[model samples]
Target: QAGTALLLLVAVVVAALPAPSLGWGVDGHLIICQIAQGRLSDAAAKAVNELLPSGAGGNLSSLCSWADRVRFRYHWSAPLHFIDVPDNVCSYSYDRDCKDEEGVKGRCVAGAINNYTSQLLTYGSSSLSPSSKSSDNLTEALLFLSHFMGDIHQPLHCGFASDRGGNTIDVHWYRRKTVLHHVWDVSIIQTAEKDYYDEGAGEFVDALNKNITGAWSDKVQEWEECAKNQTACPDKYGSESITAACDSAYKGVTEDSTLSDEYFGSRLPVVNLRLAQGGVRLAATLNRIFGQSKA
Candidate 1:
């Protein structure tokens, strides 16, 4: 009986763990699809095609693969000095409002670069080296970089001080004790499935592309503004405040409801827009490193 109870407890604990969240927008995938489809300068298209499997499939998974690899190769060096710091601290700006000094770091951009670089160095180096040009690890690193770059851009992935990037903050999403980060990661993907229903990869690609062009500027501006505003630091950008904002923004909506036109409605545009920007920036970064001009 005692062994059975322990097993059950272990199962419960495992079940309660949050899922991995990937900070991606629909537009990111859309831009990849557009680039794949459009007139690429032979070299750029060839590079993209090599990254993608069949030079098709513009789904989130495909795009994520591309982004992960790109980011892994470029930003791996920046994060080694900063990951141990709390998200709130990392996101905090002393210039804006200095409250608790315990967990607060500096600003999000620097933090993001730090966090991103750390993940890359840890994962990418073990997988590939920057000096080697002709190894499979290099390929893997590029893919990891591609996905991680997108991940860091996500405001939440930079993390929050209070809840460990929403790990601790518990809330009910349709009665389940879901954390803010997990909700953004899984629930949002589930929601995307329900709304803007796409049966085929082509349709999915089309949807992603259409939305990406529409929202890229706004997403970049949002990050840029946040970077510029001193007041956007610790006090306002803390984990608690971010958690509250996410809960308020995306609470009751479920997978089934999300599929409906009324689910996310127009708000969905932001996803693709961010994705597009990430992709463009990612490609640009890669070109610079690989001795290729930006496409």
Candidate 2:
């Protein structure tokens, strides 16, 4: 009787947990936000510091995953974390691809990015300064922007609808059984940290920062630039993600395919590149938005 009761308790606990993880893991979000906050302009930095919750201690990265944590409470936001395009489609279209399962327009990650970006833009406006009076919540906007920026960069976040961004595709990370989405979102980053960075994300961040300024220096400007001077360019980012998904993420293997050293080795560079671009573009967007805005 005790054994059966314990099994029931276990099932209850498992049922309560969030299923099918989305976006980058805690470490991935942290790394991206840390890199971004480091590159914030003086004006942007002041604004960010002013907006961050008191508990964050002026560290944006600390609250980078707040959106995910509140998904259950904010049920409407679940759809905003990802976009699902048709299976075997290698490209993304804003009008066609950026919508929720119910076919609501502007409900996907890219749209959410643009929406939150617009909300955060009101930060310095005199009429918008009083958070209590303003209809928009800049704090939540900042947190959502930071989190969704990381999400839209993850290749699988833009993966096929049939697979729920690879969430349904079961695969093995070496010897561990897990879904492909989790592989990209967490497993790969965790492996990199363990194998090369002394199990520290800070070291991994430092290494990527070095590449950003060193080998990847020439590409940084292109990554940060939005055509026609938009405050944020999520459409471009979404397009890049879907392309990368086809190129690197869903390139090979089938259901239950074992993603071992070969898969890990080749895909790690893609992961690094995406992470680098996410951080750089986030900082650039914030700089443009908060430029000359008094804190």
Candidate 3:
């Protein structure tokens, strides 16, 4: 009973403090989900609509950050939001980097993507209503999959373990003091929106949508393809993230580095590409999962 009380106290304290921005910041996740839902197949759109909570009103983007909000409540899920690779190693290995601190396998973002994708695949297969209450909590699975898709695309989410995905490396976003991880997760997107999109995330989404169908039309198919027709290709995404982390996210600077116009200018394009790819891949994964289901 004392232990339970202590745990509850800790939870209260943690909840009282401002939560660290994990995964992509709220807007980042929102942009990705918005882009994804717009590209969903007819069947996937229907399944997603049915699976979303009643309050969502068919807008998946509105709740794209739900997984992050539930971290304190779902303590075990905290690890599911990012991967930690060896410091100075510009690569990711599922067997090596996908474990939690206790060494449990399949606990990182990629594994979470695979797990939630599998869970959501059960939709429309049950004799009962696909959206009905179930042990797998398919609604939660849908939300998790949506959010993790965004997280796996943020390069620093796959950053070096020693720096805790750049969380430990102090940096400045223009003049404000922050961490490198936060810069990738939130600052870059926010700056892009402010500078070019009139501070509207919706406008940013519109620009990405234009690129998806316009400039990036040729690449979208390749981005969505999974080897051997796998339901989700998170391993590929993870690998891409680590490589981007090395080449772009962690390329320059050390502790106390100030990131300004030059840093933001170079990194914003990478951010845009990753966000676009995340949306396309998520829609592709969901389409594969629910495309054949009679909804």
TM-score of each prediction: 0.49, 0.93, 0.93
Compared with the true structure, all predictions reach lDDT values of: 0.42, 0.92, 0.92
What is the lDDT for 117 in model 3? 89
Error of 3 at 186 (Å): 0.6
- Give me the overall lDDT of model 2: 0.92
Model 2, residue pairs in steric clash: none
Badly placed stretches (over 4 Å) of model 2 are 1-18, 127-133, 292-295
TM-score of 2: 0.93
Choose 1 or 3, whichever is better by TM-score. 3
Candidate 1 lDDT, tens digit per residue, 144-226?
Answer: 44554454434454454455455465655444566655554444444555555553434545555454456443553343233
Error of 1 at 197 (Å): 2.2
TM-score, candidate 1, is 0.49
How well does candidate 1 match the true structure, expressed as C-alpha RMSD? 9.4
